[model samples]
Target: MKEVLVGSACAIALALLAGCSAEQPAGPAPATRPLDPTAADLVARAGSYYADEQVLQDAEATLVHRCMTTRGFRRPPPAPAAPVSHDEEWRPDPAHRRTDGYGLARAGRGEPPDPYFVALAPAHQERYQRELVGDMARRATLDLPSGPQLSYPTTGCLAESRAQLYGDVMEATRVTSVTQDLHNTVYLAAQADPEYRRTLARWADCMKRRGHPYGSPQQARNALAAERRSAAPTAAQRHEVAVAVADAECAAEVALPGTFESLLRRHAELLPEAQRAELNRLATSRAAALRHARQVAQR
Candidate 1:
């Protein structure tokens, strides 16, 4: 009896050890952080953009569809219509005098608004009155400095608040492009002449006078260089030419599009193996040099 009882006790002990061997140690859980909308808003604000939720959310679906379908991804459904503020400065010269006012004071000066801006008669106008004023408030919150300078979010006129939760900074982001940025800026400046001439003509027709005004800055720079010598530019002027040329090259490259893979496949196959990138690099440099030379010649 005692031997049988001892054997049974040993069997139970072995079963207990087997169970222990099969057990595993528990690991620590992952750390989590809470959402901070204010901090997020501040970060979004730092991007130097401002717009109502209307604008960003308005483009959500269309943008997603275009972006994704082209890349072969599942696209989301479209968003609702954009929330429009009362003000629209892109309305042209008749309504708001002095175009975007360079974020200047709100005096409603020299303004003859479009005849079409009617808001369902009287009562709605008072409600939407805040709409335009609200836009002003949002822009004021942005604290834009007054000067004959570029507007905030430089590309478009502000339609609403300046802060975007998810802003479109293609213009801002393009500044970082490796081979494209510098050349593009120069390209824009180079082509700015006709614009300058046109603006000058318009301002002149308005009985205003400012040489090299209302057009491309090169008009101004060229005018400045005219004082020294038209044939030979100074070293400083040569440097300006270099910058303008580089910027122009970047712009031309930008206007010419197609992904590197697709574009290269079409043309690169025609080139010798060793000449692909080297050819590009040399051409880019030569173009920049020629622009600098032209500026010097103009000087």
Candidate 2:
């Protein structure tokens, strides 16, 4: 009986050990994979990693920009008019307007500004800067979402987003200014021969008044692109446009700078050798591109 009891206890112990071995024991929980980060985070990461990767990005951007520009990309024109400065009008300084507007224009010392010109005037820019800063302060103070009377934010959102938006708008304004200036200057350049300027301006102004609206070099160009995109022209229109384009190209081909060597020699004093070489290369490349585009357009 003693031997049998001992054997039974041993058997039970072996069974228990076997059960322990076969049964799985729990360990620490598996870690959760992190979630995908937000746009801001991704941008931040890109900025960090590619902070110095300007060469490739810059080169690509430049090429694309040149292509777009040659293809007649244009920003909108200058605001026809900007809002008057109510605050300035209220203060009622008689001389300020004369100085800010007429005086600077005549003196040629600084920019004579309405709302537009003051920003560029080195001398008076500070004054307008102060005014602008004050305006921004008021905007910021009134930036809350609760107002019933407020319109679209001239400066909207908060923090960086607001800053980015404001910057984009401001840049648009500056471009408009410069573009309009370019338009004006091109007119002035034409005015060097007054009879021609008068003739062209009269025709262009008539076109503008009739609501055609493509009044400047870039505008006419962009309009041509837009028109081409919308429809295939009628046979008569195509023939007329083709004839006009061919005439212009014939004139332009004759007007190409005398030669590459002449260009370098003439601009030798003002332009560096590398710059001249690059400019020549660019001009040659651009001419080739223009010829290619013209050929495609004709077909």
Candidate 3:
């Protein structure tokens, strides 16, 4: 089983602050231009990469298991979880909205412990780690054209798998970062839009009427997190569920999801030609990688 690295509560709080924002602004015009062919292809390719990587990971796990067994060790192959569908990431589902507050908390839940890892002896565990990550545990830093340097492990099955899928790790990282930045820009734009702000205000008012006064979804999430730290952790669960349901209700009442999606679609059109070309390149690369993955898995 993978060790659940529990950072200090302070660190976790800081991380939550850095990673999530409660408020999402109103979206773009409904008739905004559709995604161009290149962009559409890129999106499809990016989506497919998840499945491709699973294939590669499975193959890599098998290789590792075989290698370990040959050395007189009992190591079971990895069991990858089913792929999650993110089609509704932006879409609001009224039926299940109440089940997970904004769905963010639910999405962030950690994976269950791996049975294979749990069965290993302490010495074998150390040996397995060494073999998977490499004895030297090498690291490398790639200086990106923008942002902070990308530091990555230069050893391990994880590293090897990535290398096999994306030939040049640094280039792949750069491309991924660029795509992410594009999405972030769109999100920021939506947040600043007057229409989005108005809808958010309406949502806030709705929540207030429900006896859960919150300025934004982020505030509610933060409050729930703080409550969990209290002596009665489970006590907050009911409140969390209530708030989440209300959040979704408010979002639906205001047509916030539709607006957000419209804005995202509009912003996607603003992607630069160079970025589109890079996405195309990435798509081609991933296709090849997927083929390679299938062959490796078969062997």
Top candidate on TM-score is: 3
Across residues 107-218, which tens digit of lDDT does each residue of candidate 1 receive? 2356556343352357655534444333433331121112122323322222221112123332222211212322332333433445433443443333223221323333
Model 2 misplacement above 4 A? 1-153, 156-172, 191-233, 256-299
Question: What TM-score, computed on C-alpha atoms, does each candidate reach?
Answer: 0.19, 0.21, 0.63
When 1 and 2 are scored with lDDT, the better candidate is 2
Worst 10 residues of 3 by lDDT: 83-92
How close to the true structure is residue 48 of candidate 3, measured as C-alpha lDDT? 50
lDDT ranking from best candidate downward: 3, 2, 1
Return the TM-score for candidate 1, rounded to 2 decimals.
0.19
Clashing pairs in 3: 1-117, 1-118, 22-218, 26-196, 28-263, 101-244
Which candidate gets the maximum lDDT versus the true structure?
3
lDDT of 2 by residue, 1-299 (tens): 55554556547768776532345789988653221222111112222222222222333233333433343433232232222232111022233332232111223346344554333557555543433333354442222111222222233222222223223433322222322332333333433444443433544555455444433333444455455446564533453244233322322333312222122222232333333343344333323333433343343
Candidate 3 on 1-299: residue-level lDDT in tens? 98898777667867878654446888874563345554443443333545655675566566556665665667556566355333242344555655554544454578877678778888988877776666463667665323557666556655565566567655445445554555566667767778778888888899899999998877887888877667364556677778777777777788878776566656556665555565556556656656766776777
The per-model lDDT (C-alpha) reads: 0.32, 0.33, 0.63
Q: Candidate 2: what lDDT? A: 0.33
